[model samples]
Target: MPVTVSIAEFFSSLHVSGQVGVTREALLPGDSEQTQALLSRAFQDACDDLPGGLKADLECCHAAATAAIHYLYRVCQALVDRAMSEEQVAAICAAMPPLPTSPGEMFSQDLALRHLPELWSMARSMSDSDPLVTGIEQAALRFPLSSVGIALKNSPDLLSLRRHDGLWRLYIDRIIARQDALRLEDASTALAVADALGEHAHSLAPKLAARLALASAPALSAPSILSLHP
Candidate 1:
């Protein structure tokens, strides 16, 4: 059975007396219902003041964590029941590699690779209004291998898509420029390229914003923005 944690108990567990050196054991002098009630009321008041959106986000994060814990618990329980050897368990675990990039990616990969219906169901409970969460859900729906594309015979420099016969046909759009760089005619071309990128321009927004905001800003210099990556 799951243990229920009361607000008073939760606060008592903190035991943050610092220099006073107050321990959790010292907090509870006796079984005082009034003290517990007061602590619970204080906790409720603090929670009530928090923003609704933030609270919802916290709840969603909690749900995802709980789902992951449930998955790990089941895996451990199954291994123990089967009396699997330590080496066998290690070998099975070795197949699923970890991604240190982000937690969102990690959870999405877990849901996809484990094929956990309950985990996905829990994730779907969160609101899809956020783009970050939407990206995660889309990733979870597809197989992990599908996300990790197979090796290509030839690496292409550019990919293009055009509308032909009411269908979007994709093709390679390659142009060899002088010294592999775009020689902009004027500021108009630069502005046009920036406009075409749209939201993608925000990728350098932080760096640009920081430079502009500096008190002793250095002379401005433009970098090649038309570079393509594989």
Candidate 2:
């Protein structure tokens, strides 16, 4: 029931060079083996940096990594085709591993899902009306810590704020990186995250505080300033 083929044979069988200028290989570039090796290395690197308790849970990490890769591949295919039905989106979402509970588990899972925001943004740009975009948005929001770079519609729930210092620091760093693109709600959420971090906020405070101040500042006309002077 199962068939196995070498990577070269598989690519050759696809007949990638024909009247159709675009090929599956063009859609998903890079050697299959190399891609798998890269994913494996990334997973291992994340595991190495994980906390002692989480480092031992390789099974959970492996599952998360596999889910993330599968989700990415499926979503990318849909994006390339520019035709993802609501049913397809639903199926993809249903296939995702459920969000884990513990902070350690959450962090481990986010190591892979952190790349979702960029894909979500691409989907949004492609067609906000598309169900696929909505599905991707929901997925990104579900992993709040990983989706900090996204211009959130609303603040992440309080439970997301309960992350450990490392996750909080990562969140703040992403927020800082996206500071220029932050919307009003995004800035408000960043301020709340900073408040939660307290002393840990460190350099994030000045940057966020200044941005908030600028956002709250009212625009003044020359006439209004002249009237005030008179």
Candidate 3:
């Protein structure tokens, strides 16, 4: 079975001390339930590594981590703080690899930017929406090669889409299309999107889409965008 989680249990699992729980819970906007669930699962897995029979200490550690995770979620919430629904997270995770799997897996993997472009690109809006993920990007440095490769090739279209202003257009069609004919639900796509976006894809899609729409332009100027993350 998919180890699904409930909002209550998710929060409880993180609150070892029961102290951070109430405050953290109090600040949360109800729309963040899904991200909360994701983080709860992540911390729960992290706590699983406690040494043999150290249940007491484990609880302590779990609570602290839970608090941190909760705090992190709160941070993510305030960043964009918009309503990024669970359906979005599930849809994204379905195509991406199992999220880090554990705490060590979370930060220890040393994942090369070369590995996760699609996920990264997809996360762009999500990341911008949630500062937690954005901050994580700063520390995690998520600029995979494939994402960069795709972004650069599409640069001309990107620049032409908008001259000097730093506006980004979000192309729902292109986004959906890129996910077509390929395994968007796989590890490669995650890595691919990140790779393609590198510094460009993730940051610029919104600009391109919005600008072209404003100018009443035909499909994006350059065909390069199509070739990316393909």
Candidate 4:
């Protein structure tokens, strides 16, 4: 029998913080205009506290959402094939290119478009392993969900992009506690996605950053190997 995996199951495995129960809204597909629009509006609502007159364009928002979905699938697929080290994950995270600062720059910029080939080449080099894929398939049986909604919740990877210079560092810190699960690469995936989405993702970036800070705060205080060492 063939094994199957749902987005929710894959997503749940990404965090060792414990599953929050994936929501229907989080699983919405990103390819369609309607879905992208919906995502854009949802992000806009999430970031309403920002300055007035900032609007999210469809193209930019769609790109952002696509990037998130793309990286999420790619990294999980990679994990399903081979176990990755913290350094390997960090290397992948480093592949994410920074976005142009303003919305106009994002829309007009070809830098992201130019970098697609390099990303594809990097992914191709990773290839697939049957045993790991099978394992992931078997694990997916316990967390199945219909494909009607989107896969990720709050686009945690993209959400982290709103933070200061500490995004990857913070993830590294959290992963010390969560290890093999919570990864700097995943945060980079989110950052790249939001960076692709440009102004569209920016509105929600601040809120996302704040939420991450709160969630990771306790992990610092909890007893861990890092604290024991120094």
Evaluate model 3: give its TM-score: 0.23
Give the alpha-carbon lDDT of every model.
Answer: 0.30, 0.55, 0.34, 0.34
Q: Compute each candidate's TM-score over C-alphas.
A: 0.18, 0.58, 0.23, 0.27
| Clash count in backbone of candidate 1 | 0
- Give per-residue CA lDDT, model 2, range 157-208, as digits (tens): 5355444545555565566556523533565455655564466444655655
Model 3 per-residue lDDT at 214: 44
Q: Candidate 2, 195: how far from true, in Å?
A: 7.5
Tens-digit lDDT track of model 1 for 28-110: 22344643454445334433533331222111122232233233333333233345444543443343333313333333233
Identify the runs in model 1 with alpha carbons over 4 angstroms from their true place: 1-31, 53-230
- For 1-230, candidate 4 gives per-residue lDDT tens digits of 43444433433343224222322222434236554454455444423422343334312444543444444444343443346655554444443323434342332222112223233334444543333233322222211110001122222323322332232232233223222222223555334333433554325444444434444456556556644554
Compare the candidates by lDDT and give the number of the best one.
Answer: 2
Query: Could you tell me the TM-score of candidate 4?
Result: 0.27
lDDT of 4: 0.34
User: Which residue pairs does candidate 1 place in steric collision?
Assistant: none
Task: In angstroms, give how far residue 114 of model 3 lies from its true place.
Answer: 19
